[model samples]
Target: MIVGIDLGTTNSAIGIWRDGTAQLVPNALGDLLTPSAVAIDDGGAVIVGMTARERQSTHPTSTVTAFKRWMGTRQTVTLAGKTFTAEDLSAIVLSSLKADAEAFLGEPVTSAVITVPAYFNDRQRKATRRAGELAGLTVERLINEPTAAALAYGIQDRSEKEPFLVFDLGGGTFDVSIVEIFDGVIEVRASAGDNRLGGEDFNDTIIEVARPRIDPEGRLAEVDPLVLHELLRAAAERCRRTLSEQEEASFTITSGDRQFATTVTAGEFEAQAAPLLAKLRDPVLRSLRDSDIRVETLSEVILVGGATRMPIVRKTITRMFGRFPNAAVHPDHAVALGAAVQGGLKSRDADLEEIRLTDVCPFTLGVDNSAPDGRGGFRHGLFSPIIERNTPIPASRVSYYSTLSDNQRNVEFGIYQGEAREVQGNVKLGSIKVPVPPAPAGHVHVECRFSYDTSGLLEVDISVPASGLVRNLVLMDDDEAPNAKEVEARRKVLAALKRHPREDSHNMAVLARAARCYESFIGERRDMVGKWTAQFEAALDGQDPRVIDSARAQFEDALNQLEGDRYL
Candidate 1:
């Protein structure tokens, strides 16, 4: 069976096409959403989701989160004396979701359609596919996140021909997609985004504001950087959420008999987040301009992703568009649901037979060429476009060029993808060395053809008509994608790690929440939390479901009263 998975930065979810509609699959904790966190327990067993997230404060050294930002890079983190690449961490999360899906379906599911940010370059895309492979699942396709959201929205309301903009701001990446839906087709006209911009940056902003006020001397960070950062992060997250609902909230962090707190108003927070919010404008305008759709002509501006819940974000978008956006789809669930829709379409489900979806190549694909510098000289690094950004997929385009020097026997093509006018500013996917017939300067003409399929693969073909020679190549970043042998070796190492029992997920989650609360509170409240956690531990030790359940409910209620409800 095929399932759809949203391998998100802050959280991940899985869904499937069951019965007549798409439905989300719940994890062992019976929750549809799972936090994208990985940790090694004291017993060296891997724990994920809520439990792992809670331990971030107490066990900051061995836990890692938000590794998605480094997906295609060479970043690595060491957990429990073992070093893991971004791909390795991602594979673990995907494996957890795969197991959850199998349990929910009562069958083994091996194939999936995964979603990635539209702005992810070729290397990032390849890295995502590799992560899926390491998880032991066949990745059927990689759908753009905003495009997937548009598909889910389009399917729900297909009554009219409407042009809309999807503003997707997730935890670690931001994307803007201009979409149009007519008849049975959902077409994404354009997409633009910043892979490094997202909600977590806002959290960092809060941390910066609170840190100086909390520890004026800056001694806390010096003692233990990891724990200090985690505590401040947790407090900042709470304050950010509280300010979303109210006008002001207290950002507090307690350590070693001392509690540091500061009151931050919503207005102040918005002002502080101004710089990050401003980065959102360029991508939105770029997408609209590329799609040739005026802002006034857009029927609806749909908001997706957890970050859009911020009041400042919504207000900024409103001011930009001169109208309120539609929030019809659940911010946290839209991508995964849309992925399930794609899965259904891949499976050719009877109910969605007539529905057609189209996406674009989000970046320009071209090769390097020398252009006249307008001074009778040549500029060696100019970029010539074969296929421009936002062009419909399953596309092929060709551009012709001539040899730069006399008696040139070969032309080297440096394939790149970007919006820059110069190749130096773009990403070099790889290069192809093609032989050409010897000739005078600009005598022998060479043809460069670029073909991009619906599944996001690129093939470049270079032909020299004079010699009837043609060379074709598939783009591959040697450093990003490892060979089959390397993949199998990494997969085996991951498979050897023990996993925490699914049946104990509830107790683990409760303990995790209590631990976070313990770190956040001080004095009398802290004592109460310690007492409650001890009681819960004793109940768990009794091995009685009735007592453990009662203890869990009480502990949860206490935490809810102390910290209010978290956004997750």
Candidate 2:
């Protein structure tokens, strides 16, 4: 069966179309949530999910998280005698989720609808697709995360032609989209985001406050640096969660000989988080402006992503829109659920026959040209837009161009994407040299057309009517982005690797959790937790699943007692 996946930065989830509704698929541990982490233990085995995240605190150098932020870049995360890119790390997560789905469905699944941040450029989108390929799945479509969230909300409401704004803040990406439900169709009018911003930054604010108190001289690097960091992070996460429930919270970093405690009130946390809150508003305004959607005209304001659960983020959005966000669709599961619905739509599921979705290109796409400013002079590098931002797709727009000078034999088609009026401020999506018949200025006219498909990929066609010459090409600007051949080669290489033992994933997760719990304590209790954690690790190396399961349950109970209600 086809499914939908939200390959989130902090966590990943999978859903499938069942009957007339989307059903979430649990992992091997029968848990709905899985941490987006990958770790290689000393045994040289690759492990993913909760176990990997827990192990990260103890094995900081061997584990990697938040690699989704590095997509479309040349960044490499090195582990286990191998240097891997963002795609490789993400493939591990996606593959683990695929295994979860397969285990639940009792079938071999080969295709999926994956979600991406709405504002991702072509390169980032392609990287997500490549990661899916490496995981042995054909990514049929890439749905915008916010749009998918909106779809999840829309499916429940029977209203028609209602406009709403979706403000999505995930673990590592932010997206603000203005959308409208026309009859039964869902159309995204505009989208804006900072690909590098997300809810994780909010957690970082807490860490910044605690670090100075714990490491005044910053000499921890010379002595047990990883443990110190683990303690600090564990405290920060607990502190953040506490503030969510009450006005004040105390975070303690106690490990071995180091002990430090700090108390922060919600007001103090909000004060420190002000800068991030401000960063959240710019995209919301930009999205409304692009879509010409006034705040009052919005029938609803939808909040998506686990970050939106933060009081400060919700308050910031309310202050800007002058309305509270709709929490009908849960922030964490909405995108994945919508992706499943989209999967159903893609497969032409009978229940979704009446539902349709259309999304716009988030940015303005155009070519560089010298255009006259109403005055006599011309402005160079002027970005002439063919398909303006917020125009619903699959769309095609054509702009006419003339020869720059007499006997001009070539037309440089410098394609670009962005909202800036100056081409230098925008991203250039490669260019092409389309041959044109040499003629006097303005005599050799050429028509350039850009077509943005449903998947948001752009293809350009340049034609000279007089010479009967036509050329078309898909744009590629970054040299690092792999082509089809390179993707296939990488996929083959990735498929050859040994799959991680899935049945042991639960043990791994609890061990990581134990490590995290161990970071927050000291003395005899710490020793006991450490001993149990080690026992489970040793048990994992044994053959009997029952032995490992028994040890895992006992260790988890020990950790729970040590952790109590404060599960840092």
Candidate 2 global Cα RMSD: 2.5
**Lowest summed-lDDT stretch of 10 residues in model 2?**
559-568
Distance from true location, Cα of 16 in model 1, Å: 0.9
Q: How would you encode candidate 1's per-residue C-alpha lDDT over 1-568 as one tens digit per residue? A: 5799999999999999878688899999888899999999888999988889889988999898999999988899999998999999999999999999998889998999999999999888888988999999999999999998998888787765578999999999999999888779899999999999988899988887777887898668655878887888878888888887899989988887778999888888898899999999999999989999899999999999999999999999999999999999999999999999999999999988989999999999998889888998898988889999999998999999899899998899899989898899998898888888888999999899999987778999999999999999987544447889999999999989899778888889888888878877788898999999999999989999999999888888888888776458
Best candidate, TM-score: 1
Writing each residue's lDDT as its tens digit, candidate 2 over 265-306 gives 888889988999889888988898888878899998888888
Q: Write down the lDDT of every candidate, Cα atoms only.
A: 0.90, 0.83
Error of 2 at 137 (Å): 1.1
C-alpha TM-scores of all predictions? 0.98, 0.93
Residue 53 displacement in candidate 1 (angstroms): 1.0
Error at 361, model 1, angstroms: 0.4
Report the number of clashing residue pairs per model: 0, 3
Scanning candidate 1 in windows of ten residues, the lowest lDDT window is 474-483
